[model samples]
Target: MRSRRARVAVIGVVVGLVTLAGGCASTDDPKANPSPPAGGIEGTVWVANEGGHSLSVIDAASSTVVTTIEGIEGPHNVQVGPDGSRVYVVSGHASTVAALDATTYRLASAAPTGASPAHVVLTPDGQRTYVTNYDAGTVSVYRPDLTPSGTIDLGGGPHGMRPSPDGSTLVVANLKAGTVDLIDTRTDRKVAAVPVGGPAVQVAVSPDSRYAYASVSRPPSVVKIDLQTRVVAGRAEVPTAPAQVYLTPDGRSLLSADQGSKDKPGTALSVIDTATMTPAGSIATGSGPHGVVIDPTGRRAWVTNVYDSTVSVIDLPTRTTVATINMGSQPNGISYAPRPPAPAEPRMSVVLPSPPAESSHGDHGGHG
Candidate 1:
């Protein structure tokens, strides 16, 4: 959500008294679901610490930050290459897409983009990477190496988006336009703009690519659109304001990261059943839970609680939070990749200094 500046500003008191800091489940207890074995949950969990100007690299199994790569100026979101070879981040202030070596957290390359880049997505096949330039009203396209390929003028506030599983289409939620742009992946051109109720915040496409779901924040609802016909099929009203939306690996349910405002932060994740396009239930989470992503194994979902500055590990089976991880600052977007282990002695780059990993109490940027 581009709501970061306002949200952080609303609660600047918590941001001070430190650069202050730092979870899931129906019980909202880390112990509700016991921690997994060393290899139980594989891969790396990447989080964009917007306020801290850093990214938190966490080992999924141990729920620990392997390292913090600090220096990104206002990283709104991050995405890992499908093969886990690299991670791409879109910095709103820097107006560039920074690609880092996944193995050593070293900056490899970067390409310029339009104003206020909000989110980044890599095609599942690793063929291309896409970034939403929020203020520019365009989506930036790039080769796998962060090479600029082209740009699609999406018309307004292009925010959260995802490529269809087959990599055929990219479903993008245009916030200011209040519409969803279905862009043909092959051509990088807009195929259609289907209207949502209002201010579409984020989107999730069905596995088959037959349907696309868009979340509207004003009225707090999820709009289900038929991708094949480009029609709004159904809409379900949710209780909390939704940020990022995710379709479970099995495609049975959709999870909405309900990150309400600072005055009334969301305390749960809203669930919608795909079968009926209706409310299934809710999973308790930390305050202002913004970014939610499920693991490759489909057994757990990790979420970033923005206001709390913590990450919650959810045990999918029981819908309970298994662990809460401390983070640096405002953790916005999250992405996971089944990755190999790092070197014996990993070192940080001279450009990217280490940021203090805070608990639920500290870290705020100069929101003013």
Candidate 2:
């Protein structure tokens, strides 16, 4: 759906591979106001780096980086807007969706979508903003202060997307038509599709969203769906191409992130166990593993290899990997904001760039 380049030639390998995971993440509630104190981290994680066309803000207590925000180009997935103060990024070479300002990182508006947005979803009272559009299958939506609010035509290659923690529904995955669609967020329409597997690149739910997972990158499985009888209730192989599935702020467990076997690229990380959803172990990490966060004290988990630019971290009760952190280029998407970056000034403008040399790489809408 997109590939024009020059977002820093590919911001260190497409922002470490479009990472994302947030249905709510904070941890040690001393009343909860953690992060940023160690060095930096007042909410903001959209990394993609793609060699630095833009997007970098790190500071998660000195993880570093802290600044870098430009429009969008080869960007890929990154979300945080919905009143958390904006961040939505998704640009496979400017198909468009920028909208920054997660506290002065800057930019603030872009929109255009419908070719390769690849992923984005919001509406827990942040108003609305869907995006998706992999190669023009379509999805647009908008309005959390950005406007638009229209488009919706999916099928074929939509990539991993979620929304159902009682928000009404909006699931989508459609990778090459393996299928998922399901829309309806209060009558935006569509309503059904459901197939799954063989391609489904990422999708997660379960904090009472009633279950809905999907990771299938060609037989390297993890399908399970049931969101109120939409169907396809089974599947679970994961080890190779399962590119992202997050969920575990207590919802039990379901982490996956495989990126392996593209000629043994394998680095692993599986983990399942959602009350017997199966496959409870795998670990290893760091090679090309693309996106899979978990900080607010879920014990640990950072992952973001994208061809070893580095980031493993992990630990979570001995899942392993302990520390890696090299983070330079090709490190796709990853986000977090238990709180940290609003001391005034910075409002958004972090520019880091200088990596690119790696390479690159969602979902939503329609059913009728």
Candidate 3:
């Protein structure tokens, strides 16, 4: 998303507030579900505060900032490790990734990565982590203990690294190259490279793992890829410049953050119905909507207005902006701690369950 002089200044201010201000689950949950609230405190959402150079911990249930961890430099993408033991944040400027203890939100360790590490993702076992190095055109794999495992050379600069549902493959978006590189997780080798929409910024996988979607910014479209065929399945256009793409918890909808044009600034959060790949509606928000996230129930979505220094809260059911809260500074990434479903009473066992098959599991340039 781009804007003129005044808008640019406003965007900077919003990002600054985000850095300075620094900023779930339920039981009654379901059978086989582990309530996020299983622990004492409410579930926590870990956000990488880019401008602030820190991490923010928010209680999902209260929607309140609980604590802040300082000393990070230009953190971009943040991911929670499997077992919920650690949170990994990538430093786009520092060329490093920080490991934080999940409970205390304290720095566990820091590992040097490739140039401009933009995002981080953990494996299903939380035993391995992948950091996308944009300028370096590589993906750095780290051990759960924060040790460097190895690096995979992607053709172009790599940005977003996401794991497949079955945990079998890791798909990365090569921003400048306009291709998605599939990595064999077990061997850390590039398996395939498939072209997609222009300037792929973010990637997401469907619940069924049959499709992988990448949000392309320049053309402002979401590119859907057929997992089996490795081909472009479909594309959905979004207005203006689409930044972050979020999938509803129930996997029924896709939300695009449309940071508006120069004069008007701000943005519009476009809601797309996944069934038809069509936009359902849009909610106006502060200037420069950068990142977005949905509540576990898929009932509400929270968006960060990078230029306005506020968060627009959208009521999914009503399809409107119900409230706007000042978050101070540029908020980049948003996530919620989904509460585990309530536990069900154990009945007499009919038969022993078989173990399910194990699974596996961009870009660009300038401020333009």
- 203-295 per-residue lDDT for model 1 (tens digits): 998888888988787677888999989999998887767788888987889998877766677888998998789999999988787888987
**How do the residues 1-368 of candidate 2 rate in per-residue lDDT, one tens digit apiece?**
23432221232132223222210121211122222233222344456644434455555554445444544444646777656677777666545676677766666666566665667778767788887766566677888765777987875667668787778888888776777777888877768888874557678888788878888766677888887888977787875666777877887888887865323566877898877778988889887677787755676666666665555666678788655555545566676666665543322343322222321322221110
Candidates in order, TM-scores: namely: 0.85, 0.33, 0.77
What is the C-alpha local distance difference test score of each model?
0.76, 0.63, 0.63
Q: For candidate 3, which ten residues in a row score worst on lDDT?
A: 359-368
Best by lDDT: 1
Clashes of each: 15, 41, 33
lDDT of 3 by residue, 139-159 (tens): 888888878989888856577
**Superposed model 1: Cα runs more than 4 Å off:** 1-39, 340-368
Task: Judging by TM-score, tell me the better candidate of 1 and 2.
Answer: 1
Error at 23, model 3, angstroms? 16
